[model samples]
Target: MLRIKLKWFHSLRLQLFVLFFLVSAIPFMFFASLTTGRIEAYFLEDSKAEWMRQANLVVSQIIQTNNYLKEGTNYTIFTNKIRELSQSEEVNARIIVVDPLGYVVADSSRIDLNTTLLNTQIFNALNKKNSSERYEKAGNFIMSTAVSIIDKEDNDKVLGAVLLSASINDIYKLLEDMESQIYFLSLIASLVIGLLSFFSSSIITRPIKTLMKVVQRVTNGQLDQKVKLNGKGEMAELANAFNHMTEQLQLVDQSRQEFVSDVSHELKTPLSSIKVLTESLMCEEDVPVEMYKEFFYDINSEVDRLNVIITDLLLLVKLDRTEIMLNINETNIKHLIANILKRLSPLARKKDIEMIYEANKEIYAEVDEVKLTLAISNIIENGIKYTPEGGQVKVKLQSDMQDVFIEVEDTGIGIAKEEQGRIFERFYRTDKTRSRDTGGTGLGLSITYRTIIMHTGSIQVESEEGIGSTFVIQIPIKHV
Candidate 1:
């Protein structure tokens, strides 16, 4: 249960959403509170300052008006003047007068004086001096200001003080409106930021999800599938890479399938032939003595072909190991071709096909002589089998001081241009229908290719359909 809960909490979309709100809300809350407090405080202070400025003006006029203050120590006479000042449009504020000993002598509000003598509003106003302001919420929210006064005759002594207060209900209302605006803005901003984060995270995770699905399909052996993406961003690049990987996988899969199918087919044909020949021999009640040599020769030839195919397959396996190296020797090209042609000459003569050799003596090359000879021999035999009766096949060896050349040129039905390049691929027969009649396991050229590569040499061919073929082998002196 704990693990499941933890996993749910840590899920990508959930975590992203939580982080979006968390990152957006905390700072927004802090800034809103700070800004609102500052604005509200500013409004309150301004309200108090405005009220105090008005109070200073009214008190100045009252103290300057000696026409109403000719009395002795009785500040009540100024009440009518203060009341008139409080009621003025220019100074719409309430006024109060108090003695230094803490008694309310006069009030514009006309509250009961004896009962309000103990009021701190009057006492604190007397205690206050200069020009400053404070706040109160008596009857309504109000700002208070105080200024001291002196007697006209004895200007050195503070006779009494003026207390002024003003209502600031509008300021409070303005602050409340500002807070409401901030609340709405914060909510809207949070929602927008959250949606942006959600979409960004989804955009990031979507392509990865698609690539994972492609991987799943590939693992299940669907190699022909390709990814299609139209974006021009990082995701598109990743998709392209994934598609390239799939392309390589498809080619590898095709190669493997063709290899297996060809192996089975090749093996079955030879096995069936051997079985048929053996069965025919066994069913013979009285085998002719003369026919025995032909029978055994045919069987031996079949066995030789099978052995060659197996040997070539094993050689390919060993070479594929990445650790094997060829045993190199400096071999004579002219002598090599001559010996091969001599061996295959009987087959050529049986069909009345001419075997020709062209040589430039003193041709030497760096090679694994035995393997090189096998490759050349295979090429020679291929040409012999394909060449028609009376058609000419040539084995040519020509050399210079720089390199040696071996060429097997045959007058026979040649290969198509498109199929020429794949001739060196293992078990690839260009004409599948005629593969058996050609007496080939299709591993001959593949083996030849590997052998030539091991010798650090090159092989190329030029052929015209229905005309002839000339396969050229070029080898440099001094093994590299």
Candidate 2:
């Protein structure tokens, strides 16, 4: 269970869910805080204003009654009026009337009378100024507004002050309710966002999971496993690329199996022949000298054939190495082809085939002469071996500023289009029986292809079923 929880914590889906939840919830919390603060500010300011208005109304009534005039001063009538105003539902508060000396003349609650009330709002009122203040008193929030009563006869003379103090506990309660609602809404939104993130993460990781499973199967030698492609995006492209890689792996596996089979068959055939010949000589009590010589000769030929196959296989292994070094040199390509043709001239002549060489100009290129010679020799030899009697084989060389081109055309049995693609594969033969009869090991073209690729060059074949074939080779003039 702990392991499962750890895995979930580390998963992309969980990470995305957390990211989305915080992205939405954090801002919602900030907005809720800001809204609550503003509401509190607005409510406090409006309540204070209303209380100030009430204080001003009391000041106006005191002025009209001439209560502040020494001869007309009536504390009893003024106290009654203050009490009457304070009892009204809209003015539900403690109302205090203070003389200019800051002594409370009357209180609506009837508690602060005759007491010296000294506060910032009371002081400001004594100076003919109206002011309001908010503070905590007796564990309750209180808002107090104080207004000055001015003498009608002398505009600057301050009569007294009316101070109204209201409890704001209901406002706080309302704000607390609003905060609860905001928290509830935020939680709901976070859950919705978390669910959305989980699904989105699933959509993204589904293809990756499929790819992982396919890779595991491939590691277990299931090269045929493939990912099923879905919608178009980077994930789709990744699946397509993985499928292509698996296909190549499957082909390589098949080719490897075929290579083993072919090598075994090729080696076994000569060994079997040599075994039969030796067995015959041993089984016979008396053998003629001529018969002995023929048997020995046959055994020697088989041995040489076996040697050839081994040598070719070893060379292929060397070429397949990633760090195989080439003995690169600037060589006269025309001379090289000429030498190959000269060496193979006898074989062409035996079949009564005409060999021709064409060159537009003398071409020089950076190449591994020994390897390149073997590559070109194999193609030319195949041409001579496969062509009908009296047919022609032609070798052409040409060059441009940066590359050299060699074209070898043979009037031989051509290859089919479908089989051309696999001709360069190891141990692949268009006609297996004909290839064996021609003494072709089927590694020639594969070796040639790898050699050219090492030189950063390219080779292609154009052939028809009944017509002739053309092989084109292109190599860079300078090695990079």
Candidate 3:
């Protein structure tokens, strides 16, 4: 049980429950206590006032009886009046009539007769002041009120004093009963609040529980799992973000599968061609020298194609690392473009494609010369390969204060708009037949894209089908 309770303490629902209960219950208890105290004080003050009024009435009656007696103190009449007043239901009190010397003349209780009583209330009455007091005696709460009795002949003269004392134990009992009821109601309210807190906590944690379940499913490789949260709150926003992340993961997984399939197909094609060529050579006995040379040359061409594909794949893997090694140098941008054009000029001449190089100014920028050259060479080479005879492949180099831009435009078979977005993806080709015939490995642009990205650069393609394509490269002037 202890362990279970400890575990529950870690739960968000339990924490919220405790928080809500305390937040609500504490203030309610405090105010209840304060209100109870106020009620007790109000009752006490009201009782004291009523008792004083009754005592004053008795004093008036005593003065009237003395004036009727014409001269002496009529102890019998005073005693009967005091006894009658004490037995009355409205003022069920202990009545005592004291003389001017503080000697009790008449006592309703029939005890303490002719005794000197000099309590605070009785003493105040003798000095012509009305007063009331409360105290505890014999385990009973008591309230005593005293008022002065004056002579009718001389109002200033003190005739005697009448003291009314009552047992207010019933008032305290009534207050105790009220306090019990209040406490019972408070207990009921606390129970209701606790129940509310429990359910409220459950409502709050429902979304979090759903999120946890989705996350668990996702961890188990179920990338399609999505959290269905309602309302536009943080939780809903989180759900949207999580769903988007899963979508991206799905796309990456699909892309990876495609890459593997393409790699297998690419490798298989060259190996199959070499196998067929070697088999033809082996089966043909005493074949012509020209035919034997032709088979070997075809075999050599397939092997070279395989080597290019493998080399590009290795380069891509290297570029994909979290940290790519770069031999950063401030190289001439114009000179680099010229060198790439010069190298690919032979391929261009074979197809009668004109290679053009234009530079606005001699710009220099920080770059890894070997990698950048390879990337740019691939683009220019592709332009030369795809362009028709007598077509133009134009290379331009220019720079701003912070960045250098390279543009390669070619009058080649332009890519379709829909396929342009994926041109930089590995093993993705716009025209697979054309790419195969042209000895394209389909990794050139992918390598170029990654290499440029490693240098914090961007490349964009602008193309229209049947027209031509323009490739724009932008790299920062400085490497940070």
Candidate 4:
């Protein structure tokens, strides 16, 4: 249990939660402390101001009596007056009257009477026209105020001074209470912030944790594993991107498996035939010359088939590369198509298929000549191969403002609708036995598809089984 808690404490979520909590709570706590201190200071100043006003009033009254100016005069009347003024619930203070020489004559809190008070406020109030105030800090804030008692007839003449000293005990007590309240509020705020941060961290990290699990599964070769998340933000976009990547990985894995199966099947067929023919020759004790020649020809034919398959496989590999450069040039499309049909005329004649070419005008387009010729020849050859004896194979070329189109139509044993979509895949054949007889490597259409794609072109087929098939190729007029 302790280990689990420690692990959790070490996790990024906890760290983020704590960081957020601190970010939210620290400033408020600091501001609260700052405000409390200001309030305390303001209260102390206000108390000092109040006492200064009170001292002025007491000084005004004392100056009117003129008792301090006379020698051997009793201070009973002045003392009684000071005592009466001091008896107030709101004012917790000591009031003292000092002569010009700084002797403490009458004190409301009478303990320090007859002693000379030595302080900046007392000395300044006695000498200067303005009252002076000062504060001292000990266990609690203490405030002092002093005012000069002047002769009424002559304002410049300083008779004596009245000093008031007050302990800001009430203000300090109020501040102590406020501090306690602030501390309580801060505690509550911290707890609330921590809880909110913890929940928020979970909300943010949930998707990341889910993605981590998905990544782990993918690392374990589970290519189909995907991150399922929903929202409208960066994290949601990230999840969608991850799912897209997984889909691509799954497709690549599937393609790899299919390719392995196809290659093995293609290689095994020729190898098995060659092995059987060679074994037959080896087992024959006294083979005739004609029989040896036939067996050797058969073996040579299988080797040639193997060579075609391997060559096609290598070409497919080269075409699959991302960095293969095209030898692009402006070539007359009419001339190109004419040459392809001329080259394949022998094959068409052997099959007794009528070859036809139709175009309204000569077309010119940017293309890789060798590859484009190969692609066109593959489609036309397939048409001738698939068509019955004396069947019609038509080739049409047309062009628009931006693109040129070529259509190869054949009256052939057409492909099944279900199998049409996969015709362009490597080593995919509609009729494997017939394809072998016709010397089809199964890579021809695949090469044609990839070559057109590399040139930013598209191809589509329209076929009905037992009727006919048409392959339409579209290539851009200008290479970009």
Best by TM-score: 2
Better of 1 and 3 by lDDT: 3
Weakest 10 consecutive residues of candidate 2 by summed lDDT: 1-10
Whole-model alpha-carbon lDDT for candidate 1: 0.76
* lDDT by residue (tens digit), candidate 1, 145-228: 776666556766665677777777777788889888997788778777887887788666666666666766777778777777
lDDT of 3 by residue, 342-426 (tens): 8788899999998878897889899999999999999999998889999999998888899999999999889999999999999
Candidate 4, residues 2-23, lDDT tens digits: the string is 1122233338677886787788
Provide the lDDT at 383 for model 4: 92
Clashes of each: 0, 0, 0, 0
After superposition, the stretches of candidate 3 with alpha carbons farther than 4 Å from their true spots are 1-12, 22-194
User: Which prediction has more favorable TM-score, 3 or 4?
Assistant: 4
The lowest-lDDT stretch of 10 consecutive residues in candidate 1 is 1-10
The weakest ten consecutive residues by lDDT in model 3 span 1-10
Error of 4 at 125 (Å): 17
Full ranking by lDDT: 2, 3, 4, 1
- At residue 154, candidate 4 shows an lDDT of 80
lDDT of each candidate versus the true structure? 0.76, 0.87, 0.86, 0.84
Residue 326 of model 4, lDDT score: 98
Measured with C-alpha atoms, the lDDT of residue 202 in candidate 4 is 75
Misplaced by over 4 Å in model 2 are: 1-169, 192-219, 222-247, 326-339, 342-346, 349-352, 361-369, 398-404, 476-480
TM-score of each: 0.52, 0.69, 0.65, 0.66
Model 4 lDDT at residue 119 = 76
